[model samples]
Target: MAWYYVENNESVGPVQESDLHALSQQGKITAQTMVCRQGDTAWVPFAQAFAPGSAAVAVADPAGAPRVSHSCVMCQKSVTADDAVQLSGNWVCATCKPLYLQKLKEGATISGVRRYAGFWIRVGAKIIDSLILMMVTIPFQFIATALIPGANDPKAIGAVIALAVVTNGFNILSNLAYQVFFLGKYAATPGKMVCKIKVIRSNGAAVTYGRATGRYFAEILSGLTLGIGYLMVAFDEEKRGLHDRICDTRVIYKD
Candidate 1:
């Protein structure tokens, strides 16, 4: 039977079974990307539809559903009648199996435990960090103003300008130091710590200060993209922003 797959929310297919397998092997199809056969009512994962002993190959009831409760280890979508595959002793839903298999094929071990931090959680962390930094910077500004309430005299004007420059410089250095130190040493700032997330490399190692600094600057690119770069964290499988992608890093929940 011919198979079809969803890509970017668009349906694509009617290709032969062999062609679908070829696409899976080629990494063109992921486990989480939905797919289905010609006779299937609901689209399933490409892996689920084609893996050995897949539910797609199973004899379903007259109603066309899985014969048992099978949950996908990745996406967690369950199906009663759709064919589910067993991989590494876990019932992987068709939607998540392809990616799992692909990871194995690529020599990447699947722990199946890394939980990516969603966008809202990251936003909450950012808000907390902003509040903390504001507490630090705001007082300095107030002191600068109190030092030279009215710049009526030349000395007062000079003092105010010098203080302004110093204030700005202090702000820059402190912010940089805050990120570089925490990310390098702890892989997270206080805010991220409060939110229970940390930054890590693709291999799950702590990021170096150099990488963290680079990621900090890459945040500028994310900002430059009209915030679309930051928004990418919402849709990405790895919960990566533009900066995270640039640095080959991911923000995930801490165990």
Candidate 2:
């Protein structure tokens, strides 16, 4: 039984078998610990017994100089240290957090960092979709408030109520139907399809309902600024519209 520190991927161990078991049960040691006994070529977990002083080794260097340790996950992206992210054992630069997160959300394990959707494409898509929703709703509103007068009239109120209910329900139906069936199933809407674009997970996995819901609500943010925020996609690095970023989605080539 013993204890070891697994920093930077190297293990220093062989404390005491009883101590190791106690640490394991106390949650100090994990199954991933690489403990090994003296004269053993292979490493085992903390649960195994090992000779004291067996884990320490002379970390060799090319020039016998102090090694400038490089990050296990990537370059100088010290995420957990400087930033308050505290994501995991690895570190990442602030600029790379979103990119790394997107890959993670999509079920991809990327070492270091990789780019995902940028601010523009995510925002812009949201703006456009919200506008489309508004366009769809305007007619319904007009018909409910203006065209149908005396909405409070008992005799005709029922009809007006029915119309309003149907109209209100349409937005929800459209959102669910279009997103689940068209976006999820076909990967695009009429406009997106026509533009030869498709929405996909950053890791290229199938879209899920939760992600689609995020995209759906993100439309409101884009609409908040009359779609100016959405139009910002034209200048974004990833060409992401607002909604795309909000949903952690990307619009890419259809093919």
Candidate 3:
């Protein structure tokens, strides 16, 4: 029987069983290393694949049938061939197929696995960001109010309107700057950093300044949708919000 193992995130060649054991003894292969037999469509931990009486190995059934189990690449769960779908040479179980297809549609690099941030956690991060922005904008609000003339003075109406416009414009620019700076440079805002989540391109590349700015503006659509866009994260297979979908971005946990 021939076996393969994952090394440095790449699948290594098919070796004989004795060679696999030798590699294990040399510390080149560990129990947690993913391995699969040549005929198997699923990859499993080395320990599970070779453990005594492990079900991962094919066995002869009393009914003269072969019972072979495969592992889902997305969830790492054992499943029969009939229960899994092969995509891009990887086996994904039915439960993970929808999400996998979504990733594929978005051109996301589906290597190994990913843990996406859920709705409540994202909401918490948004709350933190809102509080921080409030702290920043409140002082500006006070200054703007003080600069405006009394409402009773009809002559000052034009000045008040001008002041209001300038203040609002400044607020918008500042907010845009904040988002663009953090997301472009670090791939996360302070709130997302606190939550241990980061935004990245669907292709698993780093976010650029232009993409970050566009994403900041795209959030307006999310807000305009009466928050249905935000709520989509709860039901989305990859936990993507409307802005994420529009910008082809994904929020995932840090390694």
Clashes of each: 8, 20, 0
TM-score attained by model 3: 0.56
The residue-by-residue lDDT of candidate 1 on 23-139, one tens digit each, is: 878888877556766545565666666568756543233232322455566776654333677654356766766888887688664565566899999999999988999898899
Over 4 Å off, model 3: 1-112, 151-156
- Model 2: lDDT of residue 179: 68
Model 2 scores a TM of 0.42
Residue 173 local lDDT, model 2: 76
Q: List residue ranges in candidate 1 displaced over 4 A.
A: 1-112, 147-164
lDDT of 2 by residue, 48-138 (tens): 3333765544333322121233232434532223232434423555566687668779977474333333444444554676677778777
Ranking by TM-score: 3, 1, 2
Candidate 3 worst ten-residue window by lDDT: 58-67
Give per-residue CA lDDT, model 3, range 1-255, as digits (tens).
Answer: 888778877667679999999999999999977787765656777888889887785333312123356578778887656668877445789999999999979977676755688999888888887788878787877777676765335678887677778778878887898889999999998999999989998757899999999998888889899999989989888888999999999998786
Model 1, residue 61: distance off in Å is: 49
Supply candidate 3's per-residue lDDT for 186: 95
- Model 1 lDDT at residue 81: 36
Which number leads on TM-score?
Answer: 3
